[model samples]
Target chain A: MTEARDHVVPRRLIEKPAGGARLRNLGQYLFLAPALVFMLLTMVYPVLSNLRMSVYDVNVATFLSNSAPFVGLDNYVKVVSDPAFQNAFRLSVYFTIGSLVFQFTIGFALALLFNRSFPGNGLLRALMLLGWMLPTVVSASIFRWMFDGGNGIINFLFESLGLLDAPRHWLIEPNTALIGTIVANIWVGIPFNMILLLPGLQSIPDSLYEAASIDGATPWQSFRRVTLPLMRPVALSVLLLGFIYTFKVFDIVYVMTRGGPVNATTVLPIYVYQLAFNFFRFGDGAAAAVLLLLPLSIVAVGYLWLSQHEESSS
Target chain B: MNASRSNRRPGWGWTVLSTIIVIGYLFPVYWMAATSLKTNAAVYASPPQIVPWPPIFKAYVDAVINNPLALRSILNSAIVGTGTMLLTLVLASPAAYALARLNLRGATLFMLLLLITQLLPAIIIATPLFVLFSRIELVNSYPALILADTTFTLPFAVIVLRPFFLTVPTELEAAAKIDGCNQFSAFWRVILPLVQPGLITVAVFAFLMGWGEFLFAITLTTNETIQPATAALNKFIGQYGTQWNNLMALSTTVALPIIIVFASLQRYIVGGLTAGSVKQ
Candidate 1:
């Protein structure tokens, strides 16, 4: 990928340019050069610089103390030891797992549901996407209000129906708070998953299904044997994409809980912000931020490796 | 006939299931709008008012006129989002064209690089970028906000634009070149115009990212004047916790534009994103 991007693909890009196409050359470069520079400056530079910053001492106190030491890898060690950090780390895993499973299951189910022709299908698809397109703050805000201990929709409905004897602490209770945010995240993420899987469903030939049914394969058996394997690439991409987006989710969690109720819902991004801006410990925050990046970088690298493997075998 | 009848059963099951699924999915958004128009008293009234009667626009009014932050944040968001779309299009379209059409030897590599850049979650770079921006005195600047935030949306533009650009054959460009146009002019005149849908998708992605940016906006900009609507919305959940009525009203307002745009352009977005996603 880097080779193709960096210095070895211009000849290929021509796509059979006729002999001496001057306008073609200029127009193509005209389109490509500026974007390359832009990515280098904004996207690539900060990432490289941050990787460097991860190694240095960057706290305000350290700036105050000329003697403040640069301890390589120590901040990573410290972040690993802190329980709050540990909890945040654990939460990221749970959040990623819970969201991926729910989003995929529900999203795939919806995709299959929408796959067949039905009445009001168009309206349903549009309405289903409402949660996905509505900004996180907007959706989370509604749910946050709904989850309010006193007047929240959950409590109000349950209490009035006489389901619960008392108002439940939906957002404050340790167990419920994480679940609340996850539910909100799932609601927001499903549309994306469904949309991705829909295309995969479309790509499958209906003839395959007809043949399967003719052979006495139930719909369940056909799905397991045929659709599941065929949609693997689409399914994997959605899972990874969901993880990439959800792992760094800020607006929803922050808007809903601010990682509160004894820090029950704090994820890594919140930790990064709190440390840098709130605690005024830039160095510590830098360290925490690096810690967050480490796990994500590993995941990114692993996915990239798998993709390369797939490309090579194909 | 039995086989046909049995096949038909699953279709009916799917219809029933989809209706139930959609209702289950839309419940929260439904609740949000429903609760927003209710009076504070009615909002909290026991047994809940799922169907708010004598609905009030009081929350909308509060969010728009009463809450000082809402207006400010929306303005700030507009400026940042517009800036991102301009920057990405002005810069990325050409590069995407080049990657798709030029003689650059590493074109596939460029495409791959863009894809790889997207693999990591933004949290990985948010803090370090935060500090770096602050050091350059660009933390509070709109330009920095737009440029830094484009990382979230621009790669998809590059990837999405590629296939579209790739579909435009070299024959048109060759003809344009023969007619004395420069390569850049040919792209603008011949190839670019053909890829307008890709450009629209790119613009939408850029706008959404800039519109929805929260972490960086909240972290980078301290002043209310510069904060986006999302940053300001976060302010509603302060030390005392949520101010639900005002928050709901603002949420309704935040969602209204997307709902409007989505109502018109959902097919494009779904088609565009699906194409981009399934390409791999």
Candidate 2:
């Protein structure tokens, strides 16, 4: 019976040859065809077009027409040298770093707090996710109202608590405008960080903590030694993803301040939008976009390399 | 006995601390609903009322009756969102299956391409898309927004769904093939059913992507009638910034569906997001 079964298995496997392999290969490619087509049309083509348009001076008049004056890196020169672009670059760096630091710290705290089993923990954690789940525009609008000079609850609360001397225009003043947007962004970002980090925290074995405690180590000491080292990869991913997401933030900045109060909050994405749509300078807009893409591409490549290396090592 | 008592005391303290933090975090959302129920004068009152003494729904009434455009925009959002979800699922499912199941050459390259696409900011693509849509006269149209949203959703759906496909055992497909099913038939009849949960998760994500889409909505649509709720509400900011009550009411309206969807599908959404990252 065993010999008969082996013969049957070998015959079945040997039945298909090169033709069947080729046919299966064709079928696999066919399955991939639709998604590949859509990606090329929507992503690949548009990105290449942006690069092409950056070289040419395409404005409102020539935008519709096929022919535009070719300016060959002049737009790049113009964008890089532009004062607004430089300020926006500075602000982008500030905003990304600020949001990442606050979001990660607070999010990691929340993750640690919720790591243990407790009554109502699951429900509370789910409720906290509401901030991340809300529409960006809705959140922006709510924050806009909350930060309103006279009517905002923020001022009212601050004044009542003696935290502020007066009702400040949070979204309008140049100095406070960027800070206000960053505050709202941090609120939106914390839940994301927590959700990602919670799993990492949970995956750390309790035995390690008990082992540390048995050695007379305190809670903080265990966290420093056992938790932080184990959580490194997760935290790195969270920070990297947070940097990428926050660096390209447009909706909150656009809706909250519109990069206003003298362009204090004009990050890179907002700058690109203003140049392209508001000013009708498509070439410069595309050039600014290409500039933005360069750093992000580097980060993305790094992320890919790290993840691949991680998989191979594991 | 003393050690156990000490543990219980800290647990209560932690719970109280967590409640306070959550309340503080959700204050803005709570304030949104409260503001919608307040009179315009009361909203600007120096000492804001913790609870509206005499809560009113007048703002909601006004938003519903006076602002017909808001309703229309919501309808437009639904249409676009549904279209994006359907199209994204159709395209992403087969691709995910191929990537997860097939021994296709250059599959790694394709996965890398999808990851790179995520890093491409919307503003980068928005410029050329606007130009292209204008050339094709698709501006101010639902299809334009849907297609743009698909660009964001498709890559995400493929990435998330691919892992779920990988979890399905290969023997299941081989068994289906033994029963005289071809590759496509086996995928459709055997594998698709197994990954239904993943499909639903991706669909929910795709729909939310379309619903909450703001950048493309504001950029691609010139006509107010064609704009989604996000863009429509944004117009109110410029035109009626003083109407805080009405504006908050409209904001609540826009946020309600997302809240409902998230509350119901929190498990799937969280699972899908973490599964994509943690597995890799």
Tell me each candidate's TM-score.
0.90, 0.95
What are the candidates' C-alpha RMSDs? 4.9, 4.0
Interface RMSD score of candidate 2: 5.6
Write down the C-alpha DockQ for each prediction. Answer: 0.48, 0.51
Top candidate, metric DockQ: 2
lDDT of 1: 0.75
Error of 2 at A267 (Å): 1.0
Tell me the tens digit of each residue's lDDT in model 1 across A70-179.
Answer: 77887677777889898988888888789889999989988887777656676777678778877788788777877788878777677768898988788889888988
The reply for model 1, stretches above 4 Å from the true place, is A1-30, A61-69, A158-163, A309-314, B1-20, B239-242
Candidate 2 chain B: worst-modelled 10 consecutive residues by lDDT: B1-10
